[model samples]
Target: MWDYSDTVKEHFFNPKNARAMDDADAIGDVGSIQCGDALRLTLKVNAESEVIEDAAFQTFGCGSAIASSSVLTEMIKGKTLDEALKVTNQDIASELDGLPPEKMHCSVMGREALQAAVANYRGEVWKDDHEEGALICKCFAVDAVMIEDTVRANNLRTVEDVTNYTKAGGGCSACHEGIEEILTRVLAETGEAFNARASRQKLHASKEKPPVPGKGMSNLERIKRIERVIEMVRPQLQRDRGDVTLVDVDGDTVFINLVGACSGCQMASLTISGIQQQMMEDLGEFVRVVPVPANHAATTGVTA
Candidate 1:
């Protein structure tokens, strides 16, 4: 069973702006019965200010999909088109207090519907995704560019992460191979190899006395190694207006403190686990992580 957060349940049961707008300036209706999820998004814009005067949605799918649509409409209201364009799937998930990873595509669908709706309003082509590259996932109409962008943006490593984030290989299992190819290229572009032991190999192969990648190292060296990996991870979190501060390290147990938009989120523990997983993958299985209590960080006045 999956844990549906309070925010997701709240919006699912009592959705906001879940209605058809006959007078909408622009409308985007997308998805299919095959996918078990579809969204129709409508918007009314202020002619002069270009602000979104109102937004509404009609979604057909799971509770998360409906909640995602409801929350997306609520979040973009009163914002300018450009501001709304900046709202990503991560923002929708965060607004819902975070979704189960497998349901993340529901949030992605909401963002896509909004973009399609906005494109209609501006008299632009509804899907410019093709301009980025050829189509890869026929089931969801996912293209190469979209897949690559999602992989790089989230630092996704596994085939499952790609499916969860982009819905590319979620349909037929055939695209899994293609998605893996793209993921490999993206990871290569980061100048790092995939596999949980790749970084360890790098450490062992180096002669410059660089910090080793796991346990049984000096505290200072271990901290240096972990901090280096965090440097790679933090920017993605910060891009979503969330942050994690290193509180302390105890053997395999690493402590982190969430900050910024993530500070009050109900899914902070999930976020911490994600951080831990990434860190362990990079450094080794010897590492585990937990979020430090807010009270502790508060008293210590630590910033993420």
Candidate 2:
């Protein structure tokens, strides 16, 4: 289970502003059914163009969602419209005491809902400055420049390859549109062709492992063993400026991705085949270790 923050747990168990305002000047609704988190906010503006009257919200989400909405309402209740608009998503996240990395977007949604409500009141169009130019990543709020920089720095080629450098479409699948756009921009900007053979060669080299005969293990057991090994060896690997993750397990061979400060470090290749490989070997002879490429696939948002 997720460790809920004290403030987040309190708001979740006993949410405030859980109803619509009777004479609300504006109402905003944002979210998609696919994401399983939605919010509805109502605001009543006073004569001085401030939110002096009242505010309320209804949220269908996990603790983060409920806390984000509840806290947002409380924060904006007595503030002027301008002050309320200044309450950023980061502000909301911080007010909740904190939210998990994945849940940061929920706080972001709360901010979006508030902005939408204000815009609805003013009859203004909604625009995301984060996507003013280039292209927009519908999935993770990333822009073309962000995707291109990540790809070029990491030497990524395919759509999946982009995931490692930048988590563009790793969130809501709705962002696939933005991914395709960024991919096109990258291809056009580079004017360089993708070499299928080279890509395959890189992938294959990353998956190297000696063949092991007939020693079988259930997938769950292998996964559990891999997880244990990952936790045990992570600190040691980090000491050498590297981190490891279980990518895939085929038969007895376990594929791992070494990343972060270690990605392009001088000893990366050696550490993967030497230290990590040796550690897994102690587990079982059939456990062949492979160093999957840094650019393998996008990390889907953490499972809630």
Best by lDDT: 1
- Give lDDT per model, in order: 0.78, 0.71
Give all candidate RMSDs, comma-separated.
9.0, 14.8
Clashes of each: 0, 1
Tens-place lDDT digits, model 1, residues 44-110:
9998888999999998899999999999999999999999999998889988988875677788888
Please give each candidate's TM-score: 0.54, 0.48
Model 2: per-residue Cα lDDT over 62-153, one tens digit each: 88999999999999999988889989887897789877755777888899899988887888976644322343554344566778777767
Over 4 Å off in model 1, which ranges?
A: 128-304
- Candidate 2 lDDT for residue 76: 91
